[model samples]
Each structure stands twice: as structure tokens, then as C-alpha cells.
Target: MQRNGPIALAFHSLVVVFMLAPMVVVCLVAFTPENTLAMPWNGLSLRWFKAVFHHADFMSSFGNSVRLALLSATISTVFAVPAALAITRYDFRGREALNALFLSPLIIPHLVLGVAFLRLFSLMGMGGSFGWLVATHAIVVTPYTLRLILASLTSMDRNAENAARTLGAAEWTVFRRITMPLMLPGVSGGWLLAFINSFDELTMSIFVTSPSTVTLPVRMYMYASESIDPMMAAVSTLMIALATITMIILDRLFGLDRLLVGKG
Candidate 1:
């Protein structure tokens, strides 16, 4: 493997700092004692963090966001597994089309999808329902799960599966015992990716969310529209922390570098 030259290393460091600077600022602002999102803090404080829980809308929305992300990610993974299997294991009509359909959301603008979903659900009289939001989120996140699992499947050796079958192991037994265990890392990584995307989602969520189904990101947008405060920073900081922790857990369990580099 070739090592990065000094120029490449410097460029990478600068890019990383550029990307992280906003998050660092937000984390710092979250500790500001002042009410506004201004610099030169009057001393570090946790008041805004405390205020985050006190705000009724934010609290409720945070819970809703958590539930939505979990459900969407799990469901997406369940659906993705089978689709990925079909794509990688069998030759069938529309296989390419099916893969394309699964990945369509990535190419299409999210705002357009949001409008389409809104209009479709309205016609079905299911507009603004929690289930409606979950379904949409699953659709958007499925491709991530499918791609991850497909990568895992494509890289998997067929010898184990063949050996199991030759030993009279049923198809389900081979899958449940052999394939699934090997695919676990991909499945887990996919779930984390979907969860992060769903949790941070705002564009499509903005269209489908009802007053009753408002998520944390949408709520944050609404609040920021009316107010400028460290509370928003606190909320952002918390979200950043949650995502960071998730990534750390993923790295510990699955070797994040291996997973991202398609070695899973």
C-alpha cells in the first residue's frame, strides 16, 4: 500500500477540519451560558442542555424520532436482505430493474419524493399518519441496507453454503446458520447508516410529518425559525454525540474501516 504524501496528508487534514469545524462550534455553543448563539461565552454552562428536556415539543419530538429511526432501519434491513439475496444469488427478469428501483431514491431529489409521497398519501387518506412516515423512511433507507448486504453477499464464499447442502442441510438451515452469521456485520452497518439518515432527515419528513408526528429535526427547524438560542445548539450537540457514539460502537463491533471499504 502506498502512503499519502505530505501534500495529500495536509489536504486530508484540512478537509477533515473544514467538515468538523461547524460541529465543534456547535458543541462549544452548546456550553455557552448566554441565551443567544454568540461567541465569547460568559463561562461554560449546562443550562441549555437542561433546557432541552424541559421544552415539551422537543422532548416529544425526540422520542418520536428515536422510534421512527429504529422501526424504519429494522424494517428496511428485513426487506433489503431478501432483495439483496435475489440480486446477488439469482438471475431473473427485472433483476436489474429491481436493483435500479431500490436505488432510485438516491438519484431522485428528496424534495420531489416528499411532494410525491405527500400527494399520494393524501389521495389514500393516510396522510400525516405515523405509519405513513415510517413507510416512506423505509423506502428512502432501503437502498443503503440493500447495497451493504449485497456487498457482503457478493464477497461471501459459496463453499460453505454448498457444503451445508451436500450434508443434507435444508436451504433455511444454511441461510439461518451460515449465511446470516456471515452477513451480520453488513446488516448491522446498514442499520446504523439507515438510523443516522432517518434521524437526521428533515426534507421529506417535513412534508409528511403531522403536528402529531413532528420529528426532532423538523421541530428544531421550526424552533430555529422563531428563535436564536443555545438550545438549538444543545440539541445539535446531542445529535452529534449520539451519531458519534453509534459510529464508535460500529467500529468496535465490525471494524468500521473494513465495512466501509467493502471488506465486510
Candidate 2:
């Protein structure tokens, strides 16, 4: 066991570095003084970061992505909380099937779902509608929120709920005061996951969104197709920074191990 421990630790370190290297590179390149992208020292400067803010298209798309992510994550959580609660707290016909249905989107390929949405929206004459984009993102991200909430629900102690009900506490009151507080960590984790997914979504957004509603990822894709520059790196770095901050906050508040694996 002791011999294996060092090997396992080394393997884990390598895996983490492998996963994070690209992001670190992007952040490094974002500080390049030149407009072009290159590694090694360029006498680090914030020119690209400044350019990203001044770039009208990038700014607009960034706003759109933030709006869509917030809306989609909030709506997905709202729908998922009830579904998760139902699946865990009640026994009903088709419960297993219903769970599968909510999770089906995760199994489906994003490209295939994008194509399907394009066809469906075309038939409905709602192609390129912002509402359709929001709805599709919500559907795509709901499974994540549902899974987290379900994990919390399953791990939570039921004795408190039972005692509250036994003492004549109403169902709504029990849920509001007891259940919701206990579920907050899962809810927040799910929301953050959903938000990240929605914000980073490109394939589905490309099919459903109009030029006016283009998301940051899609916009970045289009820009990259036209040119390669440190501006893209700057945008990516900003996103990475935002995600890192969010994770840090969550880790401090509820502990990610508890939220993800139900253990602290």
C-alpha cells in the first residue's frame, strides 16, 4: 500500500496538470503584449485584455452568453428541483422512466440535438428565436441540476422531515424551512454547473440563435475562424477566472466533496 501511494499521488498530479495546462497556456498568452498569439515570454502586458473589453462584438456576445446562462440555469433548477423531489420522495408509476427521460439529453449528442432543434424550430417557424435558444439550453442543462439535487435528496436525513410532519408542520412549511435549507448546497452546485454548460454551449446555440443572439462561445468560434489572436485567449482567461472564482466560493461555502460525492 505504501509503495502504491506514491505512484497514485504522482499519477493524480500528472492528470491534474494535463487537464489544466491548456487553460494555463491560454491565460499566459492572454497577457502577451503583441496582438498575435505566441508562447514563451512576450514581456507580459494587458493589451489583449483591454482589447477584449473594447471589441464590440465580443462584449455583446459576452453579455448574451451571461444572460442566457443565468436564465437557462435558473429555469433548469426550478424545473429540476421539483422533478428530483418527486422522484426521491414519492413512489409512482413510470418513475424510473421519468428519471431516464430527464437524463436523456445528457446521453444524446449535442450536434444531433442541435440538428433536431433546428428542424423542429423551422417547422414551428420559430427558428433563430431567443426564446427557443433559452428553452433548448434549459433542456440540455436540466439533467445536471437534476442529478445534483437528486444526490442531495437521497443523502439527506428523513428523520427531521418526519418529526416536523408529526408535529403538525404543513408540507410546504417542512419543505420551505427544512428541505430547502438542506438542499441549498446541491441547488447551488447544480445551478453553477448548469450555468457553465449553458454559457459554454456552442453547437446548439449555433443552430438556434440568430446573429443578434449569438453567445460568447459561438462568437469566439466565428472570430477564431476569421483570425487567431490574443483577444481570444483573453476571453478564455476571463471565463476560466470566473469559473475558478465560482468553484472557490462554493468550496468555501458547502465543500465540493460533499456536494459532488455526498461525503466531506
TM-score versus the correct structure, for each prediction: 0.94, 0.94
Write candidate 1's Cα lDDT for 41-135 as tens digits: 56788989999999999999999999999999999999999999999999999999999999998898889999999999989999989998999
Taken over the whole model, the C-alpha lDDT of each candidate is 0.90, 0.90
Question: How badly does each model clash, as a count of residue pairs?
Answer: 0, 0
User: Which residue pairs in candidate 2 collide?
Assistant: none
Clashing pairs in 1: none
Alpha-carbon deviation at 117 in model 2, angstroms: 0.3
TM-score of 1: 0.94
How much does candidate 2 score in TM-score? 0.94
Q: Which residue ranges in model 1 land beyond 4 Å of their true spot?
A: 1-4, 258-264
RMSD of each: 2.1, 1.7
What's the distance in Å from true for residue 16, model 1? Answer: 1.5
